[model samples]
Target: MLTSSHCAIEIVAMAALRQKQAFEGELNRIAGTRLTLEAQVNAIETANLNAETMIAMKKGAEALKGIHGNMNINKVDATMDQIREQMDISNEISDAISNPVNMGIDVDDEELKNELEELEQEQLNDRLMGAERAPIEDEDDEEAQLRQLQAEMAM
Candidate 1:
């Protein structure tokens, strides 16, 4: 009777130990699966952050490019307007110089010309008046007188 009871107790303890080992193995497998899922979640979050950053950078670059393009167009238009204005001014100057008579410009100074003519007439009158003086004695008559004196001395 004692031997049979002892064998029965050993059999029950062995069964209980196998059940504990199987439970521990199942717990270990569940823990490993949870850790693997957590790692995948972290990796996905990092990838999402990088993607969002790249998208925002692209948007900013596009916006700046559009603004710069508009500014360049405006600058070009302003420069062209200035060039056109300069060309118009140059053409006006050329036309004004080409047709001075039509623009009421006097080519000659009439007052200055009249004054110069009056002065020339006055000088001519003065010269004519000077020419009316008595005629000068001839140098030849004086030389003949000197020669007659020298002949008288010689005699």
Candidate 2:
């Protein structure tokens, strides 16, 4: 049989072990609760930030729409039209500047008319010499063209 004092001491040691286990279980439960609370707070914070971002994007889109209302498409088209008009005027000026004889300042009207007539006469001679054509009843046209070309070439 065991001694009574030894038995009492064994019982006290068992009680102490049970108390220690209870304390550890309570500490673990408290720590788990604290972690769960921190996770819930973080999740709420993320959701709130997402909602704020969505609202800010919507407001920015609305502001851009308002700004577009003030922008005019017709004004842009009108500006392009003005640019095209200026380009056409500039091209006309370039053509005028490049041709001094056509400007009427260097050559008189009579001289211009004579140069155009001479050019026509040369074209007629080219057509006659470049290709063979059937004989025409109007011999006067050929005689007049030949005389003009020969006279110009002689000079």
Candidate 3:
């Protein structure tokens, strides 16, 4: 009995070791894939940044030229003032709407609302698509058949 128990324990320990090695190998493979993906993302972001920098440089040059040329200085100032006023109004509206008291709700979560809206939209789309079926006959025939069925059912 003692020998049999020892054999059983040894078998379990070997299996456990094998499982551990397999898990470790899988973890390493996943880590490798993650690193590769990160590298690819970095490369793409670097390229995007380079392009944005070039565009910003060109825009800045044009802006400086316009400023130096004094092109409609008063018009620019008026537009800036109008923009500032609009931004202030926007901020006020945002502050009011974001407040629970203004919203008249105790637990108002914008994220939850957005998620619920998305789910509702998805459900609406599903119902629209799922309820569609081929027409059994022409519109005239269908109307006549429906009327006949309704008359019989009423009787």
Q: State the TM-score for model 3.
A: 0.35
Tens digits of lDDT, candidate 3, 64-148:
9987786577988998999999999999999988876644556659988999999999998887787767446557988889999
For model 2, name the residue pairs that clash.
none
- State TM-scores per candidate: 0.44, 0.49, 0.35
Candidate 3 weakest ten by summed lDDT: 99-108
Segments of candidate 1 deviating more than 4 angstroms: 72-155
Q: What's the distance in Å from true for residue 32, model 2?
A: 1.6
Residues 57-108, candidate 1: write the lDDT tens digits: 9999999998786677779899999999999999999998887474565557
- Residues 11-109 of candidate 2 have per-residue lDDT tens digits of 999999999999999999999999999999999999999999999999999999998876799988998999999999999999988875744556578
Model 3 segments beyond 4 Å from truth? 57-155
* Model 1: worst 10 consecutive residues (lDDT sum): 99-108
Best by TM-score: 2
The TM-score, computed over Cα atoms with residue i paired to residue i, of candidate 1 is 0.44
Deviation in Å, model 2, residue 71 alpha carbon: 4.5
Structure candidate 1, residue pairs in collision: none
Best by lDDT: 2
